[model samples]
Target: MRILILTHRVPFPQNGGYPIVVGNTIKGLVSMGHEVSLISINVKKHSGRQHERDDLLNKISYTEYGIDTHISVLEVFSNLFTRNPYNINKYYDAGFEKLVLQNIKDNHYDVVQLEGLFVGPYVAAIRKNTTAKLIYRAHNIEHQVWHRLAHQKNDPFKKWYLNLLARRVKKYELELLNQFDGIAVFTGEDKNAMESFGAEIPLCVVPIGVDMGKYQPEPDKTECPSLFFLGSLDWLPNREGIEWFIENFHKEIVDGDLKVKFYVAGNSIPEDFDEYDVPDKVFIQGEVDDALEFVNSKSIMIVPLLSGGGMRVKIVEGMAMKKCIISTTIGAEGINFAHGDNIIIANNAGEFYDALKRCIADEWYCREIGENARKLVEQEHDVNKVTRDLVAFYQSVI
Candidate 1:
C-alpha cells in the first residue's frame, strides 16, 4: 500500500502531542510494509530543529513548506469579517495548496491522509487532482474544543469571539464529512459524535498508541509522594487548567501539612506565568532532556484539562510507564479505563485535592492503580497492534 500523510506541523522531535501522534502513525504504517510519504508545514517554532528520524528519514520521502503561525492583532481583527473559521483560515497557504496538488499529480498514492482538521482545506485540491482515497483523521471534534473553551471564558469579548469561531468550525467540519471517502477518529466517542452530526461515511476508531517496549516503568528512579503535570504550557487548555489549579487548590494543599511536592515540566512556559506563591513546592521545570525519563521519575501525573478534545498522548504514555494518573473527565475523554481501576477522575478543585491526599496516604492503593494502568496500555495500545489494526481498516476502506 502507498500512502501520503499531510500535517499542519512537522512531526519530528515528537516533543508535543500532535507530533507524537503523527510520528508514531507514520512509523507504524512503514513498519507494516507500506510505502509512506509525508508533506508537512514548517512553522517558526520547529524551524531550527533537526528533522532526523533514523528509522523513517532514510526510508520515506518528505517535504516541508514554511508558513507563518503567529497570532497578531491584525489577523484577529481580519478574522472578524471572514466567514471561514479563524483557526482554519490562519493555516491555509496558497503555496501549500499548490504543493499538495502537485504532489498528488506527480506521484499517485493509494490513500492521502489529512492529519487533522487544519489540513482539511486541501481536500478539494486532492479530490480534483488525484484518484487516491481521501482519509480525514479527525483528531477530535474540532469545534467542540472551541465550544468548551467559550463556555469557560470569563471575558465578554473573548467569549463572544470563541462562540463565533466554534459555530463556524462546526459548519466547516460537517461539510467535510461527506467530502472524504472515510473518517478516522481518535476514539469511539468522537465517532459517535460525528455520526450524530450526520457523518455517514465509513469511520474507524484509531486511538493514539505508544511504543510499549520503550515505555516500561522504572520503580527505583521514581520520586514517590510527588505529583507532576507535563504538557505544552503555551497551549490555552494547559495554561488555563494550571491557573485554575493554583487559584483554587494549590495553596490549600500546600498549607494542609501534606508531604507532597508538585512539579511542572514542558516546553513554552509564558514569561508572565507566576500563579503560585511557593516556588519550592511547585517546581516549574521547563523542557526536560527526556520526556519518558522525566515521566518515570514522577509518582503521580496530573492532567487537569478544563478544555480540549481528543485523547492526550501524555496520558497514554503515562499509563504505559505505570504512573498513577489523575485527570478531569474532559481530560480522560477517550481512554477506556474505570475511574478507580486504572486511573483516577477528578473534575473540580475539591475532588482533585482529595484524590491527591488519598494517594499520599495509601501507597498500596496508588501502586495498584499504576500497575493496572500499565497492564491496560500494554494490552490495548501497543504501537504494533494499533498499526496492524489500522492497516486492516485501510484495506477495508480501499
Candidate 2:
C-alpha cells in the first residue's frame, strides 16, 4: 500500500504529544512493507527538529513547507468580518495547497490521511486532484477543547471571545465531516462524539500505540514517593492544570508528614510560571534532554487536566515505563483505565491530595499499580499491533 500523510507539523523527534503518535505510525507502516510519503507544514516553533531523526526520515519520502502560524491581533479582528473560522482559516495557505496538488499529480497514492482537524481545509483540493481514499485521522474534537476552556474562564470578555471561537470551530468541524471517505479517531469516545455530531461516514477508533521495545520499565531506578508533571508547558490546558495543582495541593503535600518532592519537566515553560510561590521541594526542570529516562526515574506521574479532549499521550508513556499515575477523569479520557486499579482518578484537589498521600505512604501499593499500568499498555498499545489494525481499516475503507 502507498500512503500519503498530511500534517500540520513535522512529526519527528517524537518528544511529546501527537508527534510521537504520528512519527511512530509512519515508521510502523514502513516496517510492515508499505510505502509511505509525508507532507508536513512546519512552523517556527516546531521546525528544525527533524534532524534528530535523520534515520527515520531516510526510510520514507518526506516533504515540508514552512509557514507562519503565529496569531496576530489584526488578523483576529479581520476574521470577525468573515464567516470563516479564525482558527481554521489561519492554517489555509495557497502555496501549500498548490504544493499538495502538485504532489498528488506526480505520484499515485492508495490513501491520503489528514493527520488532524486543522488540516481539514485541504480536503477539497485533495478530493479534486486525486481518487485516493481520504482518511481524516482526528487527534481530538477540536471545538470541544475551546468550549471547555470558554466555560472555565471567569472574565467576561475572555469568555465571550473563547465562546465565539468555539462556535466557529464547531461549525467548521461539522462541515468537514462527510468530506473524508473515512474517519479514524484515537478513541471510541471520540468516534461516538463525532457520530453525535451527525458524522454518518465510515468511522473507526484507532488509539495511538507506543513502541514497547524502546519504553521498557526500570523498576529499580524508580524514585519512590517522588511526583512529577511532564508535558508541553506552553499549552493552555497543561499550564492551567499545573497551576491549579500548585495553588491547591502543592503546599499541603510539601508540608505534610511524608517527605516527597515534585518535579515539573517539559518544553517551553512560560515566564509567568515562575511567579507561583512554590516550596523548595517543587523543582521546575524545563525541557529535559531525554524524556523516557526522566519518566523512568520518577515514581508517580500526575496529570491534573481540568479540560481538553482526546487521549493524553504522557499518561500512556508513563504507564509504559511502569510508573503509577494519578489523573482527573478528563485527564484520563480516551484510555480504558480503571481507578485504583491501573490508575488513580482524582477529580478535585481533595481527591488528588488523598491519592498523592496514599501513594507516598504505601510503597507496595504504588509498585503494584505501576506494574498493572505496564501490563495494560503491553496488551493494548503495542505499536506493531496498532499499525496492523490501522492498515486493516484502510484496506476496508478502500
Candidate 3:
C-alpha cells in the first residue's frame, strides 16, 4: 500500500512523544514493505537574531526519517499580528495544505495518515478530492490539554479566555474527526474520552512502543540517587508536571534528611519562562537532547503531571531504563501497567516524597522493581509487537 502521512512536527530526533510515535510508526509501515511518504508540519519557534535568521534561512532542510520523506515547513503571516499560543499557531496553516493537495492529486496515495486533530482541516478537503482512506491519529484530546492550562493559570482573564477558546476549538476538533475513515488513539482511555466528547467516529487504540534495546535496564546502576523528570517542556503537561514536582515534591524533599538531587530536563523550554531554584536541591536543566541517556543516569523518574490525555510514554521509557517512577496517578495513566508492580504511583506531595525515599535508599527493592518494570515494557510495549498490532489495525480499516 502507498501511504502518505502528515504530522504537526518534524518526527526525527524523537525528543517529544508525538514525534517518537510518528517516526516509529513510519518505520513500522516501511518495514512491512508499504510505500510511505511523510509531510511533516514544521512550526518553527525562532529564537534568533537577524543575522541568525539569515543563517537559519541558509541552513539545509533535508528530508527526515520517513520511508520517502517529503518535508514542507509552514509559517503563518497572521502570526505577526496575532499573539495566539503555540497550541493554536502550531496547527495554523500558511498554505502548505495547497501543496499537500497538489501532491495528493499527483501521487494518488492508497491511504493518507493525519497525525493530529490540528491538521484535520488540511486533510478534510484531501478526502473530497481522493479515493484514499484517511487515518486520523489523535495524539491526545487537544482541547483537554488547553483546558488544563486554563485551570492552572493564575491570571483570571487569561484563564477565562483560554478556557473559552478551548471549548470553541474542541467543538471544531470533534467535528473534524468524522471527516476521516478511521481514528487512532494512544490509549483505550483516550478513545473513550473522545466518545464522551461525542465523537461518533470509528476509533481504535495504537499504544506507543518502547525501543527495548535502547531503553531497557543496563547492567551498571546509576552512581547517584538522582530524581529525574523529562519531556518537551513546550508542552503544557510536561511543564505542569515538573512545576508540580517542584512545588509539591521539592518542598518536602529539599530540606529533608535524605540527600538526593533532582534533575528536571526536557526539550524546547522558552527563555521567557523562569529557570529558578527549588531550594538548591532541584536543577532545572531544561531540554536534554538524549532522554534515555539522561533517564539511565538517574535513580528515579518523577512525574507530577496533574492533567493531560493519552499514555505517559516517558513512564514507559523510565521503566525501560530501570528507573523506579514517582508519578501522580494522572501521570501514570494509559500505559497498561499496575502501580506497585511496574511503577510506584503517588497523587500528592507526601506520597511523592515517600516514593522518592523508597527509590533512593532501598537498592535491592529498586533492582527488583526496576527489573520487573523493564520486563513489563518488553512484554507489553515491545516496538515490533505493537507495530504489528498497529499494522493490523490499519489493514482492518483498509
Candidate 4:
C-alpha cells in the first residue's frame, strides 16, 4: 500500500512525541513493504538539520513549507474575534496547501493519513483532488488538553482565555469527524470521547508504537535512586508539570533530607527557569543527543503531567527501556497502565513524593516494576505488530 502522511512538523530526528509517532509509523510502514511519503510544515522548532540516511525518503523527498508560528500581542488581540482557534490559524501556510493539493493529484496514494487535528483543515482539498481513503490519525482529544489546562491554571485571565480556546477547539474537532473517511485514535479513551462528541465514522485505536529491537534495556542498572522527567520543554503541560513538581514535591523531598537526585532533559528550556529557586539536587540538561541513552542511564523515570492528552511517547520509551516510572493518573492516561504493576500512579504532590520514597526504599520492588513495564510494551506497543494491525484497518476502510 502507498501511504501519504500529513504532519504539522518535520517527522525526522524523532526526538519529541509528535515526531516519534510520525517517524516510527513511517519506518514501520516502509519495513512492512509499503510505500510511505510525507508532507510536513518546516516549523523551525521541529526541524532537524541535514543528516545522512539510507531511507528512500528523507526531508528532501517531502514538500516542506515554512510558516510563521509565532504569535504577537496584536495577533492575540485579533484572535479573540476569530472563529478558528489561534493554534490552528498559526499553522496556516498557503504553499503547504498548494503542495498538498498537487501531491494528492500527482501521486496515487491508497491512504492519506492526517497526523493531527491541526492538519484537518486540509481534508477538503485532499477529498476533492484524490480518491484516496482519508484517515484522521488523532493524537488526542485536543480540546480536552486545553480544558484540563484551564482548570489547572490559577490566573483568571489565562483561565478565561484557555476556556474560550477549548470551546473553539471542541467545536472544530466535532466538525472534523464527518469530514474524514476513518479515524485512528491514539487511545481507546480518545475513541470513546470522539463517539460521545457525535462521531459516527469508522474508527480504531492505533496507539503510538516503538521499535523494540532498537530500545534494548541496559544490562547493568543504576544502583542509586534518581528520578528524571524527560519531555519537550516547549510543551505547556510538561513545563507546568515540572514547575509544579519542583515547587510542591521536589523541595519537600530534598528538604526532608532524602538522598535522591532529579534530572530534567528536553529541548527549548524556557529562560524563566533560571529565576526559579531550583534545588541544587536538580540538574536541567537541555536537549541530549540520544534520548534512549539518557533514559537507560537513569534509574527511574517520571511523568508529572497535570494537563495533556494522548500517550506520552517518553513513557512508552521508558517502559521499553525497562525503567521504573512514577506518573500522575492524567499523565498515564491512554496508556492503560497498571497502578502497582507496570507503573506507579501518583495524583497529587504528596502522592508523588510517597511513590518516589517507596521506589528509593525498595530497590528490588523498583526492579520488579521495571521488568513488568518492559513486558507490557512487548505485548501491546510493539511497532511491527501495531503497523500490521493498522494495515488491516486500512484494508477494512478501503
Candidate 5:
C-alpha cells in the first residue's frame, strides 16, 4: 500500500499526542511493508526559525508546505476580510493544496490519510484528480471548541462572532465528510458525535496509543503527595480545562483540608497566568521536556478537563506511569473504564474533591486502581497492538 499522509501539524518531536500518533502510525505502516509518503505542513517555529521533526522520522520522507517565517500583515488582512477563523486561515495556503493535487495525480497512492479537518479541503482536490481512498481522522469534533467558546464568551459581539465562526466551520466539516471514504476518530465519543451529525461514511473508533515501554509505572510511585495535569498549552481546551480547575477544583482539594499540590505542566502559559498571580497550591510549570519525568514524582494524575474531545493522551501517559487517574466524566473521554475499576471519575467540584481525598487517604486502593489502569492501557492502548489494528483498518479500507 502506498499511503499518503497529510496533517496540519508536523509529526516531529512526537511530544503532542496528535503529531506523535500520526508519526507513529506512519512508522508502523512503513514497518509493516507499506510505502508511506507524508505531505505535512511545517509548524510555525516559535523563535522565527526552522523546525526539525524528531529522529524517529529522521529518515521518514515528507513534503513541507505553508512554512512562513511568520504571519504577515497581508495574510492577516486577507483572513479578516474572508471571515475565516485565524486557526484555519494559517493552513489555507496555496502550496499545501498544490502538493496534495500533485501527489494524487502523479503517485497513485492507495490511501490518502488526512490527520484532521484542517486538511479537508485537499480531499476533494485529490479525489477530483485521481483514484484514491480518502480517510479523515477526526482528532476531535472541531465544533466542541466552539461550544466551549460560546459558553466562555462574555461579550455579546464576541459571542456572536464565535457562534458565526463555529456555524461556518461546521458546514465546511459536514461538506468535507461527503468527500471521504471513511472517518476515523480518536475516541468512541468522537465517533458517536460524528454520527449524531449524520456522517454517512464508515465510522470507526481508534483510540490514541501510548509507548508502554517508556510510560510503564514506576516502582517508587507510592511516595508522593502531588497531582499532575499535562497538555499542549496552545490548545484552547487545555487552557480552558486548567482555568476551570483553577477556578473550581483548586480549593476543593488543596484548601479543603487536604494536603496536596497541583503540578500543571505544558507549553505556553497564557502571559496573564504568570506565577505571580497563580493560586499558591497550583504550580504552573510551563513546558517541561518530559511530562512523565515531572509527573513520576506525583502521587496521582489529575484530569479536571471540563471540555474537549478525543481520548486524553495525558491520561494514558499517566496510567502508563502507573499512577492513579482522577478525572471528570468529560476528562476521561475515550478510554472506557467504570468507576472504582481502572480509574476514579468525578463530574463536579464536590465529587472531584471527594475522589482526590479518598484516593489519597487509601494507599492500597490507589495502588490497586493505578495498577488496574496500567494493565488496561498495556492491553488496549499499547502502540504495537494499536498500530497493528490501524494497519489492518487501512488495508480493509484500501
Candidate 6:
C-alpha cells in the first residue's frame, strides 16, 4: 500500500509529542513493507536541526514546506470578526495546498491520511484531486482542549473568548467530519466524542504506539522515592498541569515526613518558571539531552494533567521504560490500564499526594507497578503490532 501523510509540522527529531507519534507511525508502516510519503508544513519551532532533518530524509520519502505560524496581535483581533478558527486558519497556505494537489496528481496513493485536525482544511483539495481513501487521523478533539482550558480560566472575559474559540473550532471540526472516507482516533473516548458531535463516518481507535525496542528498562538506575514530570512546557495542558501540581501539592509533599524530591524536565521551559518560590527538593531541569535517560533516572513518573484530550505519549514512553506512573484521570485517558493494577489514577491534589506518598514509602510497590506498566505497553502499544492494525484499517477503508 502507498500511503501519504499530511502533517502541520516535521515529525523528525521526535523531540515532542506530535513528532514522536507521527515519526513512529511512518517508521512502523515502512517496516511492514508499505510505501509511505509525508508532506509536512514546517514551522520554525518544530523544523529541528539540519542533522535531524537529514536523518528523516534518509529513511522515507518526505517533502516539507516552511511556513510562519507565529501568532500576531493583529491576526488575533482580526480573527474575532470571522467564524473561522484562528488556530486552524493560520495553517492554510495556498502554496502548500498547491503542493499537496500536485503530489496527489503525480503519485497514485491508496490512502491520504491527515495527521491531525489542523490539516483538515486540505481535505477538499485532496478529495477533488484523487480517488484515494482519505483518512483523518485525529490526535484529539481540538475544540475540547479549548473548552477545558476555558473552564479552567477564572477571568470572565478570557473564559468567554476561549469558549468562543472552542465553538469556532468545533464548528470547523464537525464540518470536516463527513469529508473524510474514514476517521482514526487516538482513543475510544475520542471516537465517542466524534460520534456525539454527529460524525457518522467510519471511525476507529488507533492509539499512539512506540518502538519498545528503543526503550530499555534500567531498574538499577531508578532513584527510589523521587518523582519527575516530563513534557513540552509550551503546551498549555502540560504547563497548566505542572503549575497546578506545584501550587496545590508541592509544599505538602516537601514539608511531609518523606524526603522525596520532584524533578521537572522538558523542552521550552517558561522564562518565569524560576520565579515560583518552590521548595529546594523540587528541581527544575529544563530540556534534557536524552529523554529516555531522564525517564530511567526517575523512580516515579507524574502526569498531573487537569485538562487535555487524546492520549499522553509521555505516559506510554514512561510505561515502556518501566517507570511507575501516577497520573490524573484525564492524563491517563485513551490508555487501557486499571487504576491500581497497571497505573495509579489521581484526579485531585489529595489523591495525587496520597499516591505519591504510597509510591515513596514502598519501593517494592513502585517496582511492581513499573513492571505491570511495561507489560501493558508490550501487549498494547508495540509499534509493529499497531502498524499492522492500522494497515488493516486502511485496507478496509480502501
* lDDT (Cα, tens digit) per residue for candidate 4, span 1-398: 88899988876667899988888888888888888888888886555467455354652246677776889899899889888788986777777899889887888999999999888778887898999999999898899999999999999999999999999999888988989889998888898998988988899988888999988877475635877889887788998898888788655555675567778888888876655435677677878888888888888888889999988898999998889999998888888788999999998977877888889788788889999999999999999989988898999999
Reference-based lDDT, each prediction: 0.86, 0.88, 0.71, 0.84, 0.75, 0.88
Q: Mind giving the per-residue lDDT tens digits that candidate 5 earns over 242-285?
A: 78777876655555776777777777777666642446576777
lDDT of 3 by residue, 214-328 (tens): 6655547575567677888767778776776666555555676557887777777656434444655767787664677777777777778877877877877778877777777
Candidate 3: clashing pairs of residues: 266-287, 267-287
Clashing residue pairs in candidate 4 are none
Quote the lDDT for 122 in model 4. Answer: 83
Superposed model 5: Cα runs more than 4 Å off = 45-53, 68-86, 104-106, 152-157, 221-223, 249-256, 276-281
CA displacement after TM-score superposition, residue 204 of candidate 2 (Å): 0.5
Give residue 323's lDDT in candidate 5 (0 to 100). 80
What shift in Å separates residue 48 of candidate 4 from its native position after superposition?
Answer: 7.7
RMSD of each: 1.6, 1.6, 6.0, 1.9, 3.0, 1.6
Off by over 4 Å in 1: 49-54, 274-279
TM-score of candidate 2 against the unseen true structure: 0.96
Q: How do the candidates rank by lDDT, highest first?
A: 6, 2, 1, 4, 5, 3
Greater lDDT among 2 and 3 belongs to 2
Model 5, residue 276: distance off in Å is 5.6
The list of candidate 4 runs beyond 4 A from truth reads 47-61, 219-223, 275-280
Pairwise TM-score winner, candidates 1 and 5: 1
Which 10-residue window of candidate 2 scores lowest in summed lDDT?
45-54
TM-score of each: 0.96, 0.96, 0.85, 0.95, 0.89, 0.96
Residue 33: error of model 1 in Å? 0.7
Error of 1 at 274 (Å): 4.8
Error of 4 at 253 (Å): 4.5
> How much is the lDDT of residue 191 in candidate 4?
89
